[model samples]
Target: MENKKEINRRKFIKVLGAGATVSTAALYGCAPGNHSSSTDNPALGEVPIDKMTYRVNPTTGDRVSILGYGCMRWPLQAAPDGKGEVIDQDAVNELVDYAIAHGVNYFDTSPVYVQGFSERATGIALKRHPRDKFFIATKMSNFQNYTRENSIEMYRQSFKDLQVDYLDYYLLHSVGGGSGIKTFHERYIDNGVLDFLLKEREAGRIRNLGWSFHGAVDVFDYLLALDVKWDFVQIQLNYVDWKHASGNNVNADYLYGELAKRDIPAVIMEPLLGGRLSRLNDHLVGRLKQRRPENSVASWAFRFAGSYPGVLTVLSGMTYMEHLQDNIRTYSPLQPLTDEEKDFLEETAQLMLKYPTIPCNDCKYCMPCPYGLDIPAILLHYNRCVNEGNVPKSRQDENYQRARRAFLVGYDRSVPRLRQASHCTGCNQCNPHCPQGIDIPKDLHRIDQFVEQLKQDTL
Candidate 1:
């Protein structure tokens, strides 16, 4: 009987039409200087930066940007004092000014983001403009100290850090993970933090209240089941997660449907799946490019996130000017995917599953492995090699020699020998820290074995 890997590889080959090849240039439209198409053909370089789509919040009637700014991954710079990395306030200011001017009116931040400096830097940028011009959304991220006093101080500190009297949207950070319902209760319910925030809402200090979910479906259902009005819920949503939610266990289809049923708006996070969708395999990129010749690979994911009527805003962490510009182009006059296009995307998702690449997004949360393994780099190199068709299957295959050489050479170059997966001792120290729920030691061991097999020309 064929094993799972064999079956998946067969499916992958079937999807790609046996040994068909797609050029990187064709997948990415064309080279920068090569514009040989007809005059009537639309230029791919023309991005509508000024045209942004807005979604009105049903509860507060705020016209939030469909492309909401996620301030978690702000641009960093060497601090003037030379202590360490710090948020680049000037870059933040420029990006914020450009986004707001381009019609992005909603900004999401948290107390825990950017080493707790995100709120202050974001405040510095947004405060320069009129307070009423943009909606500021932040979170009560007191995960360690769940006591009432600590939680309250954290909440008040957000107001001070953000330079806002009232919050437009507020969240219970990372509610449905780790200890699950027990952690949720201890962090919010038992400690009276949720009740306090509820009263704050009534007092008009918090305009909207919600929670961002991570683990345990029951905890998510329980929070939603509460009779209290939830203005919105922030969720990790994207094409891949809609059906196959990766490490989250729960699919976005169910989450979004439940929220829609309750009339609760959804604020989307990870719409690009931490940049995974944007950096797809050449074949997948070719498939999308064939359908929409002008749109970006990332734009398809953003449009999919925003197509749903229940979504209030789709948050993107724009760390660079180009990312911000590209995202703005995607949302400006958002085009909802048609039924046929949706079906096509579903097909693409299935084809992607056949490739069997590790779903690591290079989040680096599982870093500094106890054994000194560069966990993210190892996984990233493996995933990249797999995506680029450099994963050798057998010595008999036509591309086996080439694939093996590329994979081995690239792996060595990408990850230092000292920090390679071969060094992992399987202590399991990094497993719990991973948001994607990857079994770190086990995966590293598998990768190391694969590397050894490739070296022996037996894979």
Candidate 2:
């Protein structure tokens, strides 16, 4: 039998080391032109900056990339592109090739991403390369189709789709996806699903056993306290949510601190707060630029998440090549933020709090709104308008015009019309579903009233 301890230790060493280098190289631009400290021979010293940072897992001392390639946002084709009728395979291949060549070894994906095409796309893209060149991580997405058979099928399909007999990291997806964890355990784990997974691990099918969480601290603690040793756990960690928990209306600081106490390696999701932190206000952006003018705004978010010690990897949904390259540079030779920089970000966080900005990370946790309202999408547009100080113009000119076009023009192509925030009856069904504890209906009313005023003014 293979030694579980040794397997985990080896994995940690590999992941942590690979990740550390990536982080360090990314700090300076790939081409050491402007940011190079010494002015020796410019031509001789022209070296491309590495695009990943590595962290050492204390348990096994494996080096992992600071920047993990997230497959959830892979480019998709309209139709007739690949097997699943989605996901541009050629683009995926290019991105994966670039990422791997640049030192990003960890590729994070799930069964549900891109309507289930992500895993297949990942497998197809990576199959040509040496298996050892990269590490693959996927999850047990037993939430939506919550059935024993369905769950089992999904788990089984992940390996097949990933084209890997063994997974470097396997996670119980979204442990905080409602009382779904209990359902998962009862349906799968308690009924020997965990046993099956563990058996596979014993057979070297799963290199690591952990979960990505999005719920209460109690739930997080429950999973962490399990007698079976977990190799790593993924969490939504970003500047905005640093002070907030996933769904429990609690601060994330407590949750992360608990993990730190237990010595669990934390894989971070949404380090950029679903790309919100990347595009910050002018004041904060200016401050960040002052600290590191060469680095992109997104680098600060990644650096802030990496500034903490317990973090194993910070994952980003890099859809474009430029985004991927920028991130790689950020993580390569990872530059941990100084205390002064951290303080500045904290101050910016407070300033952001002053604006009645909805704390939605747009994780789409409360997706498929019963009333046909694009809750997250609307919130995003609203936030953008507010941030840009064009709420009146946005509501009247943008959303209203779009709605009019949708209703008047081709309804099939456009987003289906239903209740705008103005039409919200305040049924308040979405309130509890939100992890951010936002007053959903109340805010909808406020926005709706403002939009109404705008319409009336033009009338």
lDDT of each candidate versus the true structure = 0.78, 0.66
- The local lDDT score (0 to 100) that residue 220 gets in candidate 1 is 89
TM, every model: 0.84, 0.78
**TM-score of candidate 1 relative to the true fold:** 0.84
Give Cα distance to truth, residue 21, candidate 2, Å.
33
Model 2 lDDT tens row, 206-297 = 88888877666667777766788888888877766777443354465776787888888889888877666764555666676787666677
> Across residues 271-329, which tens digit of lDDT does each residue of candidate 1 receive?
87766677677789889889887777888888999999999999998877877887887
> What value of lDDT does candidate 1 attain over all alpha carbons?
0.78
| Highest lDDT against the true fold, candidate | 1
Model 1, position 390: C-alpha lDDT score: 77
